[model samples]
Target: MKDWWIYKGDPAVPTDRRLARLAEHRPPWRVFEGKVDPDHKVPSLDDKQYAADRERGAGYLADDAEIDLVNTALLLRRPLLVTGVPGVGKSTLAYSIAEDLGLGPVLRWPITSRATLRDGLYRYDALRRLEDANLTRMQATSDEQLLDAPEAEEGDARPADAVTPPADGIGRYLRLGPLGTAFLPTDRPRVLLVDEIDKCDIDLPGDLLTVLDEGRFDIPELTRLADHRRTVTVGTEDPDVRARITAGRVQCRAFPVVVLTSNGEREFPPAFLRRCIRLTIERPGEDKLRRIIEQRIGAGAAAAAAAPDGLISRFLERRERGELGTDQLLNAVQLRLAGAWTAPDEIGQLAQATLQPLSGPDAT
Candidate 1:
């Protein structure tokens, strides 16, 4: 028996059989129904954005261990919990995975304190629907009054009939949020970035566990109308892209590549942690930072003269004192190499201001 990874994490690996391999590893307990319309369209990434997304790994290097963790998550069909300090490219990992495997545009659900599971799934605008209904009713009354008028001016032309849009089309009022759209039964898995999971309420992580484990969710509003309307097409987070929900259910053909990011602000419950494949991204070392700079700035400029080796040393020194994001070092290097501060006297002052620690003044 041969067991191979769905994503080998190599650029050279052909993705033609990726979907098949993903389906093969799915646990027997998991069920799948790929009833999605073959014609259904997801949003397309433009050339400029696509090119940028493909270069996500160039911004930060993901080591063999990180790559193995990602592959493990994919093979097991589990959500990846990525924890890191700010700017370690936890969020960027989602984009890299999506682009590397030709997964469609990432569906990002940014979490906040007020965010609930329902919020991530879909939003129903009941107030807007009610307002539209009232407006339509008034328009109809006005049209009726005009038609019922007995007298008309001799040379005046009759006004054109008013057309009222139906306010009860249910689907128009319902739009699937990022999470819901990810489970829309596309031929391939979607990449879902549940950005900043640590910021969510205490209950949210537990709430998410069910959906991630099952790979399906229901919309009650649509369910109520199921008898009359078996299928409803609704908007997704992607502009102009709508998914078809059959009998008010959204289920996955393949489990999505769900990357939930956290800044390691808080701990999650054991049960919530149990189902996820977790990866904690450590701060990049000095060697890694040099390579990242060489990749972003020209390799020639970063390695040769005027590249600011002093700035790199200053960045590492600050790391000993407090948390410092990699981008701060990149910025300072770019400034020095561009001749922003050619004078030697002001170098320390400028580097200090530019590479400020991420934590508060009280942290020390």
Candidate 2:
């Protein structure tokens, strides 16, 4: 099934027409809004953003195994379950794929102890509904009085301005959660990041199996579309000047790129694992670490260049010695730069202070 949304340009076309074109051509499972960040040359990972992302970080070293896993997920149309130590860029893989594929903004669902199927699918905005209910009630009361009064004009029989009774706001207030947003109607492929999935309750992963297998969910609160229908509107935050509206269950015409991350804290049920393509993210090599630091800390032309060689060496040595991980390396670089540490002594002190001794299970 193809995505039906289309874009027609105004007489005066803008320079960012590429963004609109990308949106127009997106597959059913993809969501595309025109350039999210226009100032940044990358255009926020929409179809038009691919070229810029490639130019920016093309040389960064990534493991062939990890790259192959990504390729397999894309080909097989299954969720890629990435298990790894924290700070090893397991979460970053989703963004990297979004950037590489020009898939628009990554929809992230940060799993917590309380995360559930409902939380991943939709979040009810009760405050907005309450305000809307008050407005509708006042409007209805005013209209009743207007109807009771005599009509000012002859044959002006318009049923007291038939107030379109506010839609049943109960279920209408359900807005798409990160997972729901990924399934919403769109023009381009979307990347769904189910981050820290191990942190969620056990049942949550099993609950996702159905959606992962069938790519459709039923919201009984809203009207159902034809069975096996490929698209539905979940809901959207009001765009400027528009009132909040609920879109039905959006079906995907094309499978989405689903990247789920786990920190190896808990084991998923075998059934849950069966529905996904699992991959383990290994620690970064020295070369990859250097590139990561340079990308994040602004190398050469962007800032006063730091001793990238020395910093990376110390970071790797400490990591090998089990004192720090990749996350600390990036943190140390930022802290050192912020503190205006350009000398060897300052770098040593900064690394030691930032990377505390690992304890208990983490040390192993």
Candidate 3:
């Protein structure tokens, strides 16, 4: 149906406003039913970074094809792989969808050269647990040491060190990461942004396949305790929030909206690529660049008119010679408006510094 469109690319829309299709629709491929921890709450949307990200995402000007791809990914329950140069708003798309759909906070997993799949799932501080156990053992005191043995005859009271409780239950040392948090079970899907995924190691992309397909993952640390400690409350990605894991497994009732961004630095495995819905963002044209400026700041602002006239034209002209990101344009505008230099030539030179090419021999 025409009304099936949830994200219409209109920045004016707010959250808590889902279309009938998204509200009633259920993924036919969904097989797991994760039980959410009633006390666990997602981070509040009032954070400063959250506000800035929401604004940037809402202002993103998505074309018709981009919009179609987003909706398609949502219906098919697949990850959206966005490839583009830096500053093209690939990562912001996830925040846009989250804000538009009333998803509380966008779960972000920033990739690095050393990043691994396990790093994004959860962390078990086994060493810290071991240290605490050692400290408890060393601090052992007897009743006679406390002078209680002389005052009152002890019948069954044992030393504090005699009964050490499984290092205070393994849950205290466990915490979920961004990827793990995003897969948490709930009626509505959470938006997950895997930023700069291409920066990860060669194996990371292929490593993500299992969870992407199953919408579930197992925590061996928690699984080991299942025999006795059935439900373990552990820390979540959200600060101060803890969740209960039943039988060491984390499943999802609704698959998260996973958006993986890439700089196209390297090629991905064909098998990994097959599972994702792909979208490519090209450099914004002069007109769209101006729109981005207006969207970020009002067109009437003095900063909008900071650069004399040919600044944008010059930017696009040099873009032909080397790769330049839109952020460089914004930076140049800010530099000009900052009153950093007075002489016209000096001002031009300073602005040029901000608009340097991101790639090519000129980059250095």
Candidate 4:
């Protein structure tokens, strides 16, 4: 069986105790009770698949400390803040855990400079709703024209202005964003990957502070309708999945495992940092890199690129000199094995293009 050390913290604490602690740390959000098709639950990897999952070269090998930090975060139900250089698998860690545990598909929010808290919470398609409403009105008019002449005569022709706009369900158009969906209540906790958070504006992290701490957010559009209706079924991140919100609020039953990844481009606020379990993903070593190569491509591919000559060794040397990201190694290997170039001189030129390091003031 694959040893998925989801939690490796505190040898002094009994394993049962750690499990119990994590179970107790449920989110403060409300439960999900709605009429809809059930969610899709992909089974966790079996022994063979698990082995394949681990051996795939792009996988991140967590050190004891990193494993401990992850376990600690799980126990405490805290958001994990992962910082690392590009291509170090900061975001992949989230998917790894989700796949290992069968936590369903991961909900990802890729952050950008213009991204904001509300952007991550929900999206209201007002324009689409309005257009749908107009279409419905036109269809109704067509149906009236097709009615028998006598029936049409019996019904007085009301002015077009008298036509009431169709109620295209507003909640139908409002879909939960990745962050909001993660806070949704469910039988099992979901995994949310917020990628490249450091690319967001300075206030983005601070804005998330409250939502993370509270584990909930409200949709005012739904809230307004809630005054008339007790429950509103709304769209979610999952396809064909709908959740019910009472009085326009969505809260979690268990806090979703939140993985916020950064590229070490910027520092976070103290308050924001305090609420998170921080992990710095160090660059993979030679053995890890070899494993990554084997995992990503195939063992045969790896052997083909690595046999006779020290391909992996040379790649590591370039990395040691801060020439390129670890992904470049994979690129180089793939090129070598594919017989892209047979001449040694041409291969070296290809390597130069593939492994060029960052230059200028930022180069280090």
RMSD of 4: 6.0
List, residue by residue over 78-185, the lDDT tens digit for candidate 3: 999999998788987888887667677888999999999999999999898998777656546543465455566556566545535464478889999999988878
Comparing candidate 1 with candidate 4, which one achieves the higher lDDT? 1
TM-score of 2: 0.68
True-structure lDDT of candidate 1: 0.80
1-364: candidate 4 lDDT, tens digit per residue: 1143445434466555545556655444422332222453323434454455433312555567777777667757789999988877787788776654556677889999999999999999999888877877886777677564555665576546444554536777888888888887765677899999999999999999878887778888888887687677777777667777777887776678899999888888999999999999888777777777887778986675565444576666567676457778888888877777546556566566676665332222
By TM-score, rank the candidates, best first.
1, 3, 4, 2
TM-score of structure candidate 1: 0.90
Instruction: Determine the backbone clash count of candidate 1.
Output: 0
TM-score, predicted candidate 3 vs. hidden true structure: 0.86
Better of 1 and 3 by TM-score: 1
Clashes of each: 0, 9, 0, 6
lDDT minimum window of 10 residues, candidate 1: 1-10
Q: How would you order the candidates by lDDT, starting with the best? A: 1, 3, 4, 2
Stretches of model 3 off by over 4 angstroms after superposition: 9-20, 47-49, 141-168, 301-308, 341-347
Name the candidate, 3 or 4, with the larger lDDT value: 3
- Report every candidate's CA lDDT: 0.80, 0.62, 0.78, 0.72
Per-prediction CA RMSD (Å): 3.2, 9.4, 3.7, 6.0
Q: Please state the error at residue 330 of candidate 2 in Å.
A: 2.9
